[model samples]
Target: MFSLGNVRVRTKLIGGFIIVSLLIGLVGGLGVISLKNVGKKAEGIYSQNLRVVYILTDMQANLERVRGNMAELIYVKDQAQKDELKKSIANDKEENTNYMSEFESINISDEEKKVYEEFQKNITQYRSLRENVIKLVDEGNFEEAEKQYVPIRKVTEPMFISLDKLININVDSAKSANDNIKAINASSNMIMMALSIIGLILAILLGVILSRDINKPLQKIKMFGEKLANYDLNFDFEVTRKDEFGQTGGSLVIAQNNIKELVKTIIENSQSMSAASEELSATVEEISSKAINIDEAVNTIASNMQEASAETEEIGASIEEVDSSVIVLSQKAMEGSNNSNESKVRAKEVKDSSKKAIEESQIIFNEKKNRMLKAIEDEKVVENIKVMAGTIASIAEQTNLLALNAAIEAARAGEQGKGFAVVAEEVRTLAEQSAEAVKNIQETIEEVQKAFKNSIDTGNDILEFINTDVHKQFTEYEKTGNQYYSDADFVSTMSENIAAMSEEITATVGQVSEAMQNMAQNTQKSSEQAEEIRESVNETTQALEHVALTAQNQAELAQKLNEVIQKFNI
Candidate 1:
C-alpha cells in the first residue's frame, strides 16, 4: 500500500511510459477503426440507396410533366395556339425519350424494364396523338385536337403509374439502407463502449502493476533505513540489476559496513579508555600507598625531631638548675673560706662534701650521655624502614609486570581488549612511580641512619670524658687548704658546665611527640584517598563490561542481516 512516488524514479518512469503507450494506442487505434466504419456506412448509403432514390424521383417528375402537356393539348382551340401546344408536347416527348434511355441503363428486373417500356410506349402513343392533333390544329380542326388529347391522357396515365411504382421501390430501398446504417451505428456504438471498457480495465491493471512495482521495494527500503538509523543493521535489501535502485542498495550496504567499522572502532576506543582508567586508578592507589609510607617516615622523623627538641629544652632547664646549684655551692665555698679559723676541720669536711657533690654531678652527666646513646640506637629503626621501602618497590615491580601481561592479552583480543591495554599502560606508569618513591624513601632512611650514628659517636666521647673527670674529682677532694681555693673554683666551674649539658637534653624530647601526632594525621588522609581510587576502578570495570556486551550484540545482528540478504539472492 505504499505510494508509487516513493519508489525509485526509474521504475516509475518505465511504468509510466508503458501506460502512456497503451492508452495512446488503444484510443488512437480504436478511433481510426470507428472512423473507417463510418466511412464505409456513408459509401454504402450513397452508392446503392441514394442513387436509386434520385433516379426514381426523376422518373416521377417526367411522368407528371407528360400528363400536364397532354391536358394542355386537349384545351388548345386556335390553330396558332394549338401549334404552340403541339411544339411544347413534342419537346416533352423528347425529354421522356431521354429519361427512358437512362432508365434502361440502370438495368432493373425484366418486369420492371417491361413496365418502363410500356410507360415509354404510352408516352410514344401520346406523342403521336399530340402530333396528329397539332397537325389538325394547324388546319383549324378543333374536334380532332380534343380526340388526340383523350388518347394522350390515356397513354400518360400508365406512365404516372409506372413512375409511382418505381418511386415506391426506391423509397423501400432507401428505408432499407437507412436501417442498415442504424444497424452499423449500433454495432459501432457497441464496439466503442467495449473499447472504452477495455481501455479502462487496462489502465486500472497497469496502475496496479506500476504501483506495486514502484512502491513495494521503496517501502521495504524505507523501513530498513529507519532500522539502520536506530543502529539496527540486521535488515537486507534485495534489489537486483544495475538500476538506480540497485545502486542505492549498494550504497546502503557500504553504509552498513562503515557503521560496523565505526562500532568496532568505538569498542576499541572504549576498551582503551577503560584500560587507561584502570591504570590511573592503580597509579592513584600506588601514590596513596606511597603517601602513607612517606607519612610514616615523616612521623618517625618528626618523633626524632621532637625528642631532640625536648632534649634541648631539658638542657636549658638543667642549665638553670645547675646555675642555682652553682650559686649555692659558691655560697657554701665562700662561707667556708670566711669561717676557716673558726673550724678548720669542719671547713675541710665541707670542702670534701663539695667535691663529692661535684663528682655526683659528673656521674649524672655520664648517665645523661647513656640516654643519648640509647636514643641514637634508633638507627636500626631507620634501617628497618629502608627494608620496608625495598619490599614496596618489589611489589610495585610485580604490578608493572602484571600490567604488561594484561596489555599483551588485550592486544591479542583485538578491539575488544583495547581499553584494557590503555589501562595497563597507566598501571605501568604508576608502578614506575611507586618504584621511584621506594628509592627516595630508601635514600631518606639512609641519611637518617647516618645522622643518628654520628650523634651516638659524639655522645660516647663526651660520656667517657665526664666519667674520667668524676673519678679524678673524687680522688683530689682531701688535698688541703693551699689547693682548696683552686679546687673549690674548679669544682664550682664543673658544676656549672654539668647543669648546661643537662638543660639541652630535656628540651629535645618534647619536640619529638608533636611531630608524631602530625605524621598520624597525614597517614589517615592517604588511606582515604586510596579508598576513593578503588571505587573509581570499580566503575571503570563496569563500563568495560557493558562495551563488550554491546560489541557482541552488534556482531550477532550483522550475522542476521547477512542471512536475510542471502534469502533475497542479491
Candidate 2:
C-alpha cells in the first residue's frame, strides 16, 4: 500500500478532492431519497385521502337535497306538483347513490369503513320509507303520506348523520396525512442541514490537512530560496520524503557542493595572484625612479642653454657701440689738421672697441654652439619621458588585469568572499585611476616635447640670424676699422676724403645698431620659449610623481585584497 506521505503531490490533491466530492454526492443522494419519500406521502394525501373527503362532502349535499324534496311532498297536493317533487327526490337519490359508490371505491380506515356500512343501511331504510310515501302520495292519500314522513325523517336523519360521520373521518384522515407530510418535510430539512454541516466541516478539515501537507514543503523551499539569496550556502538540505520537496532538496545539495568546490579553487588561485601583484608593484617603482633621474638631467641641460643665449645677445650690443665710435672718429678727421690729434685719439679708441667686440662675438658664437648641443640633449630627454609614459601605461594595464582576476575569484567565493570583492573593486578602481594618470602624464610629456621642439627651432633661427647678420655686421666693422686707420694716416694728405668717409661711417653705424636690435629681439624670444619649455618639463615631472604615487596606492590595495581573500578558510 502506498502511504499518503510517499504519494506524489498531485495524487494526494486528487484523492482529497475525490473524498470531498463523494461526501457531497452522498449528501445529495440522501436528499434525493428523502424528497422522493416525501413526494410519495404527498401523493397519497392529495390523491386518496383528500379525494375521499371531497366525495364525502358531495354525498352530504345530496342527502340534504333528498330530505328537502321529501319534506315538500307533504305540502304538495296537486298531481303535477306531486310528480315534480317525486322526480326531484328520485334525481337527488340517484346523485347521492353515485356519490356513495365513489366514496366506497376509495381506500379508507377501519373506523371509516364501519361508518360507511352504517350509512348504507340507513340510506336503504330511508329509501324504503320514501318509496312508501311516494306510493301513498300516488294513491291521493296525503294524510297517510304525511304520517309516513315522520319515520322517513327518522331514517333519513340517521343516514345524514352517517354520511357526515364518513365525511368527518375522511377529513380527519386528510388532515392527519397533511400533518405527516409537514413532519417529513421538517425532518428532511433538519437531516439535510445536519448532513450539509457535516460535509462542510469534513471538506474544510480535509482542505486544511491537504494545504498544510502541501504548503509545509513549499514554505521550506521558499526558506531555502531566501537562504540562497542571502548567500548562505552552509545549511544542510535534509528533506528525505519521496516527493517534490525531496527532489528539490537533493538538487540544492548538489548546487551547494559545486559551489564549495568552486570557492576552494578561487581561494587557491587568488593566493597565487596576490604574490604576482606584489612583484609587479616593485618593478613599477624601479621604473619610476629611473624616469625621475632622466627628468632631472633634462632640467639641468635646459638651464645651461638659457644662460648661453643671454651671452650671445650681450656680444651683439657691444659690436653696435664700437661702430658708433668709428663714425665719431671719421667726423673729427674731416674737421682739419688742427683736430688731427683728436681724430687719432678717437681712431685708436674705435680700433680698441672693435677688437673687444670681435673677441666678444667669438665667445658668443661658442656659447650659441654649446646651447644648440644642449637643446639636442633636451630633445632626447623628452623622448625618454615619452617612453616612461608608455611603460607606466603598460603597468597600469597589467594592474587592471590583476584586479579583474581577483574580482572574478572573489565572486566565485560567494558570501565568504564579499570583503575580498570590495577590495578587488577598489584595486580595480585604483588601477583605472592609475591608467588615467598615466594618460595625463603622456599628454603632458607630449606638450613638453612640443615646447622643446619649438624652443629648439627658435634657437636654430637665432643661430642662423646671428651667423648671417652678425657675421655681415662684423665684416662691415672690420672695413670701417681699415677706413679709420687709413683716414688717420691721410688726415694731412686727404682731409677732403675724410668728410665723405664720415658720412659713410655714420650710415654703417646706424645699420649695425638696427642689426643689433633685431638680434636682441630674437634672443628675447628664444629666452621666453626656453622658459616655457622649463615650465612644461616641471609639469611633466609632477605628473610622473603622481603616477608613482598612484602605483604605490594600487599596490597597497592589492595587498589588502590578497589579505582579505586569504582570510577565507574555504
Residue range 235-285, candidate 1, lDDT tens digits = 666656354555777788788777767666654455455455555555555
lDDT of 2 by residue, 1-570 (tens): 654556788888888789878878877887898788888888888787778777777777777877788778878767788788878888887887787787667777899888888888887887888889888877878899899988876787777787778767767777887788788788878888897898889889888987887788788888877876665767667775777767877788788778767767765675565566567667656766766776576667657656766776677667666776766676566567446646666776777777677677777877987997898898898789889889988988998999899999999999998999899899889989989998998899889888888887887887777777876777677678767866766765576577677778778777877777776777666666666666666666566567656666666665675665454333
So what's the TM-score on candidate 2? 0.45
Candidates in order, TM-scores: namely 0.40, 0.45
For candidate 2, give the lDDT.
0.76
Q: Total backbone clashes of model 1?
A: 38
Q: What is the C-alpha local distance difference test score of candidate 1?
A: 0.65
> Over 4 Å off in model 1, which ranges?
1-31, 39-59, 94-126, 139-151, 238-247, 262-570
TM value for model 1: 0.40
